[model samples]
Target: MRDGVRPPLRNHHEEAAEELGTTTKRDTINTALREVTARYRRLRALEEAREPAADGALDMDLLLDKRAYRPRGADSATDDHGTGADG
Candidate 1:
């Protein structure tokens, strides 16, 4: 790694590295890069799925309402103690 080339990491990256079980800066960078690449690939796959194929058939309405696929548990109702909605 080049000196002064790597940017300063914020608290979020530290927390993410801890969560990902990466102890060193090099491991954290490698893990973060892999995660970002995977996320982009997933997004690209979804974007491609929404595109019309050679058949010229596309379900715009279904694709537009993709939020329905999310897991439902929390109702966005927060508590007074500053806990999550499920609290």
Candidate 2:
């Protein structure tokens, strides 16, 4: 890993470290960076999905039909444990 000097952060390091289950500054920083990177990747994916195709026309039908992509048992009413009533 590359090492560089960073400005002193606010006093939340203790709280952040506790929340992230890390005891060292380096571990906490690494966990925080990974979370940020994952968040940005998810946002980028959503943005790309919203962009229109090269034809400038969006296929609203396929996008709106969520049932077509749902799993086989997704529509069944389940009990507290997620097993269907019949089970």
Candidate 3:
């Protein structure tokens, strides 16, 4: 790195590399970039999910209705808490 070209990130890079156990600055930077991109991707996905779907594109209630969704062979006599209706 050229001296005095810009504010140095050496300290930050070294700290991140040590914490991450990366052997080189390049690896640390790449890992950081990949993590940042992954975080943004998750955020974008969450944002998109928050946006309302097209009409009937998805039934949010159906997804929320745990009673309607059951694992195969799960007893139908009980609610999600596993308490039977007779209780």
Report lDDT (CA) for all predictions.
0.73, 0.76, 0.77
Model 1 misplacement above 4 A: 1-13, 53-87
In model 1, which range of ten residues has the least summed lDDT? Answer: 71-80
lDDT score at residue 33, model 2, on the 0-100 scale:
95
Clashes of each: 0, 0, 0
Tens digits of per-residue lDDT for model 3 on 5-81?
Answer: 75467878888998878989889999989989999999999778766554556688887888776654445545555
* Residue 27 in model 3: lDDT: 97
lDDT of 1 by residue, 1-87 (tens): 258576556666788788899987789889989999999999998778757643458666665686766545554324434577565
Tell me the lDDT of model 2 at 29. 93
Model 2 lDDT per residue over 44-82, tens place: 987887776534577777768997675545444354346
Q: Which candidate tops lDDT?
A: 3
**CA shift at 48, candidate 2, in angstroms?**
1.2
Give the candidate order by descending lDDT.
3, 2, 1
Sort order, TM-score high to low? 3, 2, 1
lDDT of 2: 0.76
* Best of the candidates, TM-score: 3
Q: What are the runs in model 3 whose C-alpha is more than 4 Å off?
A: 1-8, 53-87
